[model samples]
Target: CEQVTIIIIIINPGFVLVHFDISPASTDDPDIKQMMAGSTLRKVKSHSWKKHRHFRLLEDGLTIWYKSRWAGRGHSTFSVSDLETVRDGHQSELLLSLSEEFPSDQCFTLVFHGRRGTLDLVADTPEEAKCWVDGLRKLIHKSQTMDCKERLDQWVRDWFTKADKNKDGQMTFKEAKTLLKMMNVEMNEENALHLFTVCNLSLCVLEQHTSASLMSPLLSRDEVWKVFQDFSADGERLLVDELENFLQIEQGEREGRAQELIELYEPSEAARQQMCMSLEGFQLYLCSPHGSIFNPDHEQLHQDMKLPLSHYFISSSHNTYLTGDQLRGQSSTEAYIQALKRGCRCVELDCWDGPDGEPIVYHGHTLTSKILFRDVISTLKEYAFKTSVFPVILSLENHCGLEQQTVMAQHLKKILGEILQTSLINGQVPEQLPSPQDLRGKMLLKGKKLGGLEQRSDETITDEVSDDEDGEMERESVEDLTKDTADSNKQSKLSRELSDLVLYCKSVPFHGFEPARASGKCYEMSSFSESKVKKLTKDGKGSEMVQYNVKQLTRVYPSGMRTDSSNYNPQEMWANGCQLVALNFQTAGLEMDLNDGLFRQNGGCGFVLKPEFMRKTDSEFSPERPESRPGYRPLRLSIQVLSGQQFPKVNQKEGSIVDPLVRVELYGVPKDQSRDETSYINNNGFNPAWNETLNFVVHVPDLALVRFVVEDYDKASRNDFIGQFTLPFTSLQPGYRHVHLLSKDGTPIPHASVFVNVSISELT
Candidate 1:
C-alpha cells in the first residue's frame, strides 16, 4: 500500500496553524477555535510599534495580530495578491531604525509592501526574522502558482474596484476610459463601446455605439450584474465578507474554510464595518503594484559557491564586440555592457590593430564596425560584476601587433585596477578550478601568449625589398604573401606584460586530447568550434572531453555558418560537460530560451553546478555510449490535459476567440522530442476542456526539460504562440498541478494556465 501525506494550513490574524493527515479532512467544521489555540504548530513572532505580535503566513495572504485581551488584540491581514515585495530591514535605513532599538546581534527588521502602505515590523531574534522571511516567500510563490481562473477572478475584482471612481458599485463610461488608459490599453471610443457591449450593455449603445444613455452612464445590464454576482456570495454587490470568500477559493482553500480565511485575511476596520467592497475598491487593489514575482529578501536558494568553477556551466556571450551578425554588423562596447548586466560570466573580445596606434575590438575579417579596446575595457570595468559578483572571463582573441597589444594590456590594468586577476589567486595553480565565490569581482584575461622579443620578424627586411627595380614591388607583394602563410605556422602573440596576464587561461589550439594533455601547460584552455566538438561527441570522444572539462575549461561556439548570430542547441555541448557554451546573446529564440532556463536554476547567476556524473573524475558515463549503461532506466511520462483558463489571444482576428492547442516539448539528451495535442478547441478563451492524455518515453530523464507550450491554431498560416512553461523533468512533481503560462520574455501572464495531472513510471 502507498501512503500519502497532506497538510492543511489555516491562517488567522497573527496566527498560523498547520494540520497533517493521511487522508483528506472534512472542511464542514473549519475548527477556527482549534486553529486559534496555535497547538501542534510552529509560530513566528514579530514586534509592531514595540508591542508583541504573532504573524501567520497563509497561502493567500499574511496576518499579524497580538494574542491578547488588551487594546491591540485584534489582528490585521492583507492578501498576498497585492503584495509587491517583502524586504529586510537592512535594505532600507528607515526600517533599520526600529531594528537598532533591540540588541543588534539578536534582532532584524522586515517590511512587507502591498498595494496599501508598507507594514514595518521587527523580529525579536534573527531566527524569527529568517522564519518570517522564508514563510512569506513560500506564501508568495504559492500565490503565484494558484489556479488561473481563481487568480483571474481576484484580478477582475481588483480591477473593478479600481475603475469604480465614485465608490459606487458601477463604473461610468468616463471612468472606464480612464481605467483603460491606466492599464496602458489604447482603445478608441468604438472599441471601448464594443467591450462594454460584450458585457451585454449594448442596450445602452447608440446607433454608432458612440452615444451612451443619458442617465448617469452606469452599466445596469444583467450580464454585468451576473459578473458581480459571480464574485459575490448573494448574487448582489460584493461585500467585504463576500470578497473574502472569493479570495479564499482563488487561494485554493476548501469550500467550508471561509470563516478561517475571514479571520486570517482581515480587511480594515472601516471596510469591515462598511462591509461593501465597492467596485472602486476592487480596482484600487488590482491596479496597485502587488509584489513582484521576485522577492528582494529571498536568500540564495541555490549553492552558488559550493562547487569548483569547472563543475558548472557559465552563461557566456560570443563575439562580444558586435551587436549583430558577423558580417557588416555594428560593433559597440554596449554589447559587452548588456551581456554583463544579463548575468553572463564570460565575454569574448576579438582585438585587431586600429588607426592611431590603438587596439580596437571587432570581427577581424568582416565588415563590422570597431570600438577602441580601451572603450571595451572601460565598459567591462563598469558592468562586469554588476549583476553577479562571480568572476568574469575575458576570452581575448588577439590579432594586434606587439605595440597595440602592449596598449591593450595597459588599458586593462589601468581601468580594471585591482579587479583584474594578473596572478594565480593562491600564488600557485590549483589541482581543481577555484570556486566562483573565491574569485568574486575579479576579471581574468584569456588570450594567446607571445614568445620573447627575439621572435619578432626582422622589421628592416620588410622595408628593404629586392634591389631589382622592375621586380621590387611585385617581389615585395609575393614575399608578403609568403610571410603571411608562415605567420599562420607560428603564434601571433601578445606583449610580455599581456602574456603574463593570460597565465591561467592561455588560449591554445586543440589538435587532440593527447596533444593538449601532453603540452605540459594544463592552464592552457581551448575554444572549439561547435562543429568540431559535435564531431568529437559523435565520434565517441565525448567521454574524454567530459574528463578533460572536469579539470580545465572548454568553450564551444556556434558554427561559422550561423552568420546571422543564430545558435545551436547547447544541450549537446553540455552533455560533454563543456563549461562555456558561448552564444550570441542579442539573438532571441528557443536556444536563448533554453540557455535562460538552464542558468535560471542557480539564481540566474550564470553558473549551474553540473550533474554528479559529469563532475566526477573517474565516471564511466558516455553520451554516445548510453547503451553500455546497465543501471539506466527507460522513464515514461503520462500527462492528462484537464482544461485551460482564460487563454490569451494570439493570432486570431481582433474580436475572434482562439482555437487553443497544447504542445509538449522535451529537451535533453537522446535527441529533443515533442508531442502536440491531437485537436484544438474551437472559439473558446475562457475554458477549453481537452481531457486528453499525452505520453513520452525518455532515456535520460535526469537531463531533460519539459516545456508545455500553448498556441492558437490558424488554417491559413502557422500557429501563433500563446505562452509556455518549462521546468526540469527532475523537478516535476507527480500530481495535479497548474502550468502557469509565461510570455516569451518569461513574465507570467495573468489568468493563464493549463491544468494538468502528471504521473511518472519507470519501465523495464
Candidate 2:
C-alpha cells in the first residue's frame, strides 16, 4: 500500500498538542516521536476538600491544570514541585475515619504541604492504589535530577530579569558580562557569543545600536517552545521494562508489578498497550506523595525490642510539675499531659508537704505554686502509656515528712495499681535493669532513701534551730536545689512501702566514678548537676564516666544557672553516653531543638540504641580518648545558605520586613561549633539570597545535630528567633534540599522553608 502523511504541532498559553499521521511508507514517523515527548491526558476524578473535580497533567514541568468549560482558558494550575508528599490515604487517621464512613476500597492522598493543603482521591480497587503509590515514588525520586536540569534555565530567566538594568528588557554586552561575574561564571568574547546564540539573542550593531537596541537574552514564548522541542527526544519515553529496571525488581515478580504500575501511572489502555510513558505521566507520578521516610513494614519495625534499659537514650523531662520558672511559676497537671503526649518517657516530681497534710508536687526553696501529689499520679495513670506503651520513670524528689510520704505511697499504689514496678520481675534480682519490653506500660519510682538511725539527737538539734528561724518555710525542701553538705552523706529513712517501689533506679550521691562502682550497688543511679558533669569531663574523667554508664544509669540535669528553665546543650551530655539527659521540656530554643533532633530517630519511641562503643562492657571510647576509637570519622560539612521563603513578621509595623541571618551550629561533644553571617539582609526576609557557605568539622556525627537557625538580628540585645529546623547528621541527604522550618512549639509553619545545598566529606 502507498500513502502520504503530514505532521502538525499546536502551542497555546494553557495547552500544547501534537498531531501527526503514519502510513506504510513512513512507519517511523513524527507521530512516534510526538508520542514519546508530548503530554498525555487521562480521565480521573479528584476530590479536594470534598469537592470532586477533573484535572490534567500538563507538560510544563509537570503542572496540574484545572480544565475550564471555555476553550484556551483554564481555571488554574499547580506545579508538581509544590507537592511535598503523596501516600496511601489509609495511613492517615482522618482518612481511616473517612474509610469507616464511606468505606472505599482504593484511596490515596496528595499532600501539597506548602500552599495547596491536600488532594484526596479514591480509586475503584486496591490494585489501582498500589500502582499509583509505586509510580509516584519512582517519579518523586527523580525530582532532584529534574531540579538540577531546570536550575540553569531558571538562572537564565532570573539573570535576564536582573540584568535588564533599566527595566527596559535589554542589556549591553558589558552588562551581560557583569551579570556573569555576579553568578561566578567566567566569560570571554567566544563564550559570550555562544551564550547569545544558544539563548536566541542577536548581537547589537556596534555603529547604530543603542543600549536599548541590545535586547535581553531571555527566551520569548515562541523561543521557549523551540527550546523545549530541541531538548525533547524522538521516541524517547519510559516503558514498563525500563520502569522495572529502574525499580531493581527481581525477575520473578517484575512482570506483575510492572503491569500494575503501568496501569496506575498510564491509565489509558492504548498507552499501556504501546508500552511507553509520556513526559506528562512521569511528572504526575513524581509530584504525587508516593515516597515516604517512614514505612509500616520496615524491617526495623519487626525486630526484637529487648535490651537493657540503660542501653537506650530515654526521652526525659525536667521540672515536669511547673509550666514556667522554678522561682515562681504555676504548677499544673497540663504540664504533665503535654510532656507525656510529646513522647516523654520520664517525668520529675518535687514532692513537699502541703497545708492539708497531703503531699504536694512543686519546686522547693522557690515560690512556685503546687499541685496535689495525688493529682499528678492520676494524670500519669491516664496518660503515661497513651502515646507509647514503653516504660515510664517517675523521678520523685521526696521532701515530705514520714506521714505525708506514706500517704503519697498509698496514692501511687491505688492509682497506678498493677502498672507500677514495685518489685523485680520474675522474682529474680537482675544484675542489670530490665529491657524496655519487659516493663512496657509500667512506671518505676526513683527517690532518695531515708536513714533508719535510732538516735538523731545531734542533727535534729541543728535542724530544729534552722526551722525555728523560718517557720513559714516547709519542713523539708526538694534536695535537688540543695548542695550536698556534710550531712547529706547520711542515709535517711524511707517508708517501706515507697522504698520497695525503688527497685531499680535508686537515687544516690555521685562522689566519684570509682567509689560508685566499688560500692557494688549497680541498681543505684546517680543524678549529676550539669555543672558537676562539666567539671568532671573537663578534668579528663569523661572516659571513666562513659564506662560507669554501661552497667548503670547516670542522669544529667540542667545547671542551677538556668533558673528560668532554659536548657543547656544536651548533645554534650549525650556524647558522653549519659543515659538520661533531661531537658526543660517547657522551654523551646536551640537546646531543645537539638534534643528533639537527636531523639527523632529510632522511631521516636524515646529509646535510641547506644552506639556499640558507648554501650560496650569493657570499652575505652570517650570524648577525651578519641584515639581509642579507630573508626571514628571526622566529617567536613559544607552548607550553602541559598534563600528563604514565607518568612514570618518580626515586628508589629504594618509593612515591616525582617533583618534575617542564618546561624548554623554543630551540637556535639568536645565542643559546639557555630558560625553566623556577619551581616544580614536589611529588610527582606522573603527571598533573601546570600549564596553564603559555612563549613564545620565534626568529631562525633552519631551524637551530633546540625541546626539551621533563622533569626531576626537585633543590635542591642540577643537576636530574636524567627524559625529553625534540625536533623541528625546521619539522616541528612546531601545535595540541594529544602528544610521546612518549625515554630517555637514544634508545629510546622506552612510555606516557610530554607533552601540549602549540603556537601559532606570525610576530613582527612
* TM-score versus the correct structure, for each prediction: 0.60, 0.61
Top lDDT prediction, candidate number: 2
lDDT by residue for model 1 (1-764), tens: 11112121223222222121121112122332222222211222333434545554321132232343353645555555445446554333234434455533433334332112245555656655555555555556656665422343345444444555665445556666555544324456766554544434222322211122221123222322333467876653466557656555432334653344333332344544555654434422322221111111221436647677888889988887776787778886656766775679999887889999998888766678888898788778877877788889998866677899789888988999999987676776565666888788898877665431123332212121221111001111122333454444343433766776665575655667776555435455777777768777776777888888887788877765676878888878887889999888877667776776676555668877787777777766677765555567768888887677667666433345677888888887654356657478876655677878898887777677777888888999999888877766765655445676777755567757776667778865
lDDT of 2 by residue, 1-764 (tens): 11212111222222212111222211243432232232222222322344434454332223455543444554566545556556675533335446654344476667553223355665545655555554444445444454321333333333444455665434555566555544323356666555544423222222111111122332122322332233335534566666555333211222445556556566345777887555434433322222111121331333345978888888888889877877788787768876786678889988888888899888876788878899889889987887778899998867677778789999999999999987668877677779999998899887653321111222211122122112112122344356454444333445666665677787665667777667646667777766767888876677787888888887777765677888887777877788888888888777778767766665566777777788787767778656558687778988877666556766644445577888887776664455555357776564566778888887777766787788888889988788887777766655445666778766565445676657778888
- The ten-residue window of minimal lDDT in model 1 covers 467-476
User: Which consecutive 10 residues in model 2 have the weakest lDDT in total?
Assistant: 204-213
The whole-model lDDT of each prediction reads 0.60, 0.61
Among the numbered candidates, top TM-score falls to: 2
